[model samples]
Target chain A: MQNLALETVAPVVESVPVPKITAKDVNVHYGEKHAIKDVSVDIPAKGVMSFIGPSGCGKSTFLRCINRMNDTIPICRVTGDLRIDGRDIYEPGLDPVLLRARVGMVFQKPNPFPKSIYENVAYGPRLHGLASNKVEMDELVEWALRRAGLFEEVKDRLKDSGTSLSGGQQQRLCIARAISVRPEVILMDEPCSALDPIATAKIEELIDELRANFTIVIVTHSMQQAARVSQRTAFFHLGKVIEEGVTDQIFMNPRHELTRNYITGRFG
Target chain B: MSVLYFSLLLVMAVLAFALARGRASSGARAAAFHSRPNYHGLLAASLVAIPMLVVFVIGAILTKMIAESQALTALDPALLTDPLRRGAALREIVEVANGRFRGNPSITLQAAGDTWAYVQRVARFSIYGLGLAAGIGGLMFALRSITPDLKARNRFEWLVTVLLMICAGIAVLTTIGIVFSVVFETVRFFQKVPPMDFLTGTQWSPQTAIRADQGGSSGAFGVVPLLTGTLLISGIAMLVAGPIGLFAAIYMAEYATPRFRSTAKPVLEILAGIPTVVLGFFAALTVAPLIRGAGEYFGLSVASESALAAGLVMGMMIIPFVSSLSDDVITAVPQSLRDGSLALGGTKSETIRRVILPAALPGIVSAFMLAISRAVGETMIVVMAAGLAANLTFNPLDAVTTFTVQIKTILVGDQEFDTAKTLAAFALGFVLFFFTLTLNVIALAIIRKYREQYD
Candidate 1:
């Protein structure tokens, strides 16, 4: 019965005309540990999707695989077919550096470059050659910050250190940094986990606005956050997806026993 | 006598500690006591030990003065008028007291030696009495004062704080003492020879006559030649060390694999551990002659003891200091910065050059400063390989003498005091000290101002 529930809901999130990310039997291993078992899922293009699970359940691992952030870990290994926009991301011709530029990431803790606020946002545009001139680069930076809802607060002191900002402002700055290069997708690994409630709500609103242009995938610990920010929701348990479907249906009528147990506070 | 007195005091302090700890915990429940048993023990030990040490030091100084006076009495009144003869006579009397007389001693001298020995014994007895009194008095007072609610822990902590302060004060005071002595000697030297000549003039021949007929040797004391020589040698050393050491450090920190780093770091540090004298001999015997031969082959005349040889060896000797310190500073840069750069589509080389190096710049600058300081103060290699000729030329093929070499030459075989030749060494030392001090201050200020807080 659990297998049936998982199969039925796996393809439901990809019902759009063209999917952004497609995975088939993806398995991740960290040394001898089978961190992510053989599993499959599809993320729709230009939508907000959330992966909710207990701590250390491989939700963050699967999220890191989208942008190849897992390459930074020497012991981690990922196998099986994974594609974005109908092209294999792990193909021989694709450099992780170039792939990462197309798919940006925001971490749980805001990690800004130790530079001026203006430079932090301008770094991506300059490196990717998104802007041709200095004036265009400055404009692109301003536009990205405005889209992330940070320009108004930081416009006057653009030369100040990025670390001098408040935690909420810094997270927004990281968001602006990701958007500066005009990426096709954004991978957020518990982006609001270190933030206060107000800051978390602000980021949730920003995620909704970002869905029009870029696909967004979020790994969250909060059930309410998963329900609030995502249209499609997946529940993971023991390194495997238990059930995934429309957010309202997953919460209101969970089919699998483990998913219902986790949502109803019976067991994780 | 002072050592014996201190050892006896140490034994008494230990006994007092045991007694205090045993008594403090005798009747009360362990939980009821305000202070732990260890604090009570420490308080008792320190109370007995500190006063005893103070009295022992004072007694030691007094005993030294008394013995010196006794030895002075042996000098004849006629000889005492002459400072040099008086000094020799006192030395002889001290040898008699120690039972190692160098020559035949007169009756007056042997009698004075007996008197000195007797006085030393009396001084020892008096010191022992005073030490015993301090230990007993302090122990009795400490034991009587201990109660159930006494704040023994706080008192012990304060005592430890004072002890640490005294240790720090000793180091600072010793530095001040050295500076004052050098300044006094430099002043005396300036009074004999004008400061303008020493600072600005070019010649540097200090001639001391062998006899009256070997006269007309007023001895020019111009410091310009020595200063230029020192600078030329140091510049050559820096030219050899700066780029090579920095590149080695960059490779170690940025590109090397973990296994390579683990194996190579210690091997490089071993270079620093080798004594500088071994390098001196190698420079003198091997490198100098090789350069001279190589220069002759090219139709270029190189001195047998060229500045290039010493500078090359000195640079090699200090390479470990530069590489190891720069490696640490570069490796200390946060990995997150690299990640940020790479995620922005920058290549590995670009990330390292733009983000990591910029962030680590201040630390690397300080490493260079420290390396330069090491180069300036180096003694053995310069002393052995570089010629003693004080030449005011920038040519690396010619031999040159550094400030350290000059100082060592003047002070090695001492003939007399209050002479211009010996005092000139102290003046040179003061200039070296000032140069290194200013460099350190500038380095520290750069480190402070550009410090990137990454937490």
Candidate 2:
């Protein structure tokens, strides 16, 4: 009876055409503790895919692995095949530094560089040597800010410290910073977790707009946000992905018992 | 005798605590105590200890005065008129009373000695009686006041706070006292040598005549040479230490693993723990000759004891100060900032140079200033390695003397305090103090201004 119910309720996502990122049996360990255990998922290109789970469920950890940001931790170790555009990112020849440029990240809290608003937006472009001259760099910075929907709010005071902005503006500035590098993918780790409702709504709207051009992966605790913004939703529990499918089906009719329990608030 | 009183006071205080705690705990069964039994015990102990300590101090002083006055009464009035004679007679009387006198004593001296012994015994007994009275009275008062309603903890805490304030005030008052003493001596030095001539004149030979007919030049009291020499050596020291220490801090803070940092930071700080005298010897014996050899190879004249040698060794000694302070501030920069930079695809070096360093700039600048101040105030290295010649030049190859070195030279042997040469040490000390104080003030101001920037 259980298998019949699961088979009927589960959404069939068999036609994921040319997924932008693919992971097979990916495992992450911090020293002796396994944080992510044999997780496998394919993230399709040019869409918002949200990972929804309870806290400490390895959702953020798995998110960080995409950009190889986990390389910074001394004890953290990752194994198994992880790829972007069918190229293995974990290969010894592929530099994590260059990989990060191709895959930009926004942190849980809004972190703008302790510099002028112009400098914060220009940092990634400058680092990647994207702009050739002062005029081009200014244009690039302005374009990034416009893309992140923060250009009009901060157009008058480009010279002010980036930290001087409001919480929502700072998050947008960080988004601009990430987008300035022109990455193929953007990974956001609970980016609106530290913002108020209005700020969260604005960021959610920006994320929706951004998915038209970039393969965006977001980790959020709010199932409402996952259902509202993402086309696909992956449910994680106890360091494992329990189920993944189209967002409406995942929320309305989860296949796995664990996924259904989590979505319906029976138990995290 | 005072030892006996001290023991008596200790016993009384302990007994008072035990009695008060027992009373408070027993009363707690009937009613509720506002404070714990331990607080009640502390209040009792403090009451006994404070009053008894006061009585002990005042009694000791009063007894000495009374014994000295009583001994003086046995001496001739005419003999006591002269201050010198009075001091000698008092010393003899004290020596005889203590049974340590060896010289032959006149009849009056013998009588005075006997009176001194008698008066000392009486006075000591009276002090013992007074201290015991204070201790017992305080114990009884505290015992009577032990009730469940008494707020013993608050009262005891207030007393503790007052004691802590007094201890802190003593440190401040001692510093003020030293500053005043230096100010007085510096004023006297200025009276003998005009401020303009001492400050601006470029000569520093401080050899003055000891006697009216003694053969010596009335010294040139100019301090310009010493001032320039100090600046030159300290400047050299900062140049050497500033970059090396900052780089070490950056490497430790940004790149080194946690295990490496934990072990290496202490070892680096041990550089500061090496006795400065040892560093001075190293400077004089090893570095000085090496510099001289190098200078000779380069066809340049380097003194056997050059400012460069001293400055380099001093710089080595102060590296820990700069590195340790800079490391703390750099490490204190929010980890989130580093993450933000790294996530933007900035390389480690780029992130450190442009993001971390710029954010930690004020702290780094303050650390450098503190290191410069340490170099300026350093005495032993300059005294042993640098020559005594007060050369007014910026050349590091030449031997130069600092303010501390000159002060040491001026005050080494017996000399009259009234002379300009002797008083010159105090003036140099005052100037050195003022210079370091200014540096510290500016450094602290910079730190305070930028402390809240990241937050």
Candidate 3:
């Protein structure tokens, strides 16, 4: 795998790939509590960037900040220069409804709409008017499901409720739902946390394949998971980014004391 | 005497509880026990109270029955062959014993009344004795079982669960009792007036012959007029309330801010708290005249007390049922579902209309069915605003009586109990029961199916 990655990809820092997502001094507040402090990083385009930390370390919160999902929380307030494709997403004129359609999200728990599998995938396209007619919509749904690796198992049962699927299949259905809109960037909040080891492998494999077409940022608790699927890894603790670099380097020679302590299983 | 007996029972129960607690831990300090002392006390108290109450109730019933039989002996001997005459004679004798007999009593009647009073007193003493014996027996048995090894807590909990089940069973038993009583009287009514006529007949004047010679109204017992009137008024009410209430519920559930929702929900509920009789008066005194005057201007022949007047008020009363229940079910649609919809970039109104409504369809439907059942059973408004004319018509401008109103009218005025006119009320009640029960069953089935899908 290392031989293949080294042969196919340039050194991330040396090539200076254009940043697909950039955060400068991002902070989040939930009511009276300051949840996320100033955090800054640049995510290279078209690769998986994993955010790893202990629980309550603001990894998921930071991931949600990308698509403005925190805006739904009435008490939550975000102040930062978080940009995607060189555009400030938190600008006053920015439409979260439109931004959400462009930058999709998949949550830790698989939350499919209480609808059929076909309709679940088609919901995004129909909502944003992505498809002009029925044929285009059907083709888009099948393509998304196939890319999510759920088409073979569910093609015969597309009319069945998405909720009736197994846990891993449901998450794939959610992934299919996210991709059906042809989003530019996808934010995943611990997408594989609720799956078994085999399901987790499937999700990891899909993430590697998805890295080719979309800029993906994933928040995971497992160091091994970050090592396996991510190209660049960021370590967050106490609402601040401690270190970020190539996945192999972050796992092999972490620089910060706290990052080393967390990666070495000494203390989180 | 009952008051004193109940007091004695209460005192014994308290004493038994204390004594059992003392007995369970009566040994030296730090003695091991299977259950807590409080459980022993609770078990003992229950034993002392529940059985004694049961015996007391049984003794009271037997005493009354014996006293009645003894009083029967004071009646005239010839009347015994005819049970009906015997009952009437006993009633008069007992009335005489109370010194409220209308006519002057002869020597034999006065002597019989005296004996009847004495027999009642003796029966009362016997009941008191039996009650005391039962109470003491229960106390002794409970005290004997007050040991450290006894599983008092388990027994007490099991007993409480059984008692709770029995209390819940009372509601089921009472419904069955009502159905049986109505069915019995309805059968008697059917014997006099054919069932086919009652069900299919068009006319519904229930003033049947009270006496054979005095030519009174023979009374058409057709149920169609009242049934149609009920359906018509209820339909009007639903047509008025359905869209308005549903929209109000939608706004409250989907669009209202937290501050507004908390304020508006209870205010909507207060509509339900207003008594139906007051609504009836409002319909009669206020809305009816306004409707009639408006009709006069429009050149429509509207009755003064019309179905429109009754139905409008009924619809107002039913609004809260739809709004409050719809709000609950909408609020209960998992937050995850909402987040999923929102993440798809569906606007607020789009998400609500397409997702929330479809998800909440079953619950909303059940809420409407419940409101309709309430409307069908509503009596006071129809009786006051819609005159009790059993006119078979579909026009809302006409005054029509509902089944409930007819039931009320038939039983209220001066009438003989055995007359077909009065018995017709029971038949009406039986039919009304079937309709409301059918509605409730459908609503429940829908709700249950919904829960199965979600849960």
TM agreement with the true structure for every prediction = 0.92, 0.92, 0.92
Across A1-268, the per-residue lDDT of candidate 1 in tens digits comes to 2233443344333344567998787899999999987657778889988999888889999988888888878899999889999899888889998998988888888878777899899988877789999899899999999999999999999998898898989999999999999999998989899999999999999999999999999999999999998988878876777677789999998876778878988765
How do the residues B348-428 of candidate 3 rate in per-residue lDDT, one tens digit apiece?
A: 787888778878888898889999999999999999999999999999999999999988998886877787888999999
Candidate 2 per-residue C-alpha lDDT over A1-268 given as tens digits, one digit per residue, 9 for 90 to 100:
1233432343333346769999888999999999998888989999999999888899999999999989999899999999999999999999888989999999999989888899999988888899999999999999999999999999999998899899999999999999999999999999998999999999999999999999999999899999999999888876777788889999998777778778888766
What is the C-alpha lDDT profile of model 1 across B213-322, one tens digit per residue?
78677677888888888877777788888887888899999889889999999998998988989999999999999999999999999998989999999888878888
The full ranking of all candidates by DockQ, starting with the best, is 2, 3, 1
**Candidate 1 chain A weakest ten by summed lDDT:** A5-14
CAPRI class of candidate 1: medium
Comparing 2 and 3 by DockQ, which wins?
A: 2
Q: State in Å the error of residue B408, model 2.
A: 1.4
Model 3 steric clash pairs: none
lDDT of 2: 0.89
Q: Per-residue error at B416 for model 2, in Å? A: 2.4
The reply for model 1, stretches above 4 Å from the true place, is A1-17, A264-268, B66-93, B96-115, B208-218, B452-455
Cα error, residue B59 of model 2, in Å, equals 2.6
Q: After superposition, how far is residue B210 of candidate 1 from its true place, in Å?
A: 5.7
- Candidate 2 vs 3: which has more lDDT: 2
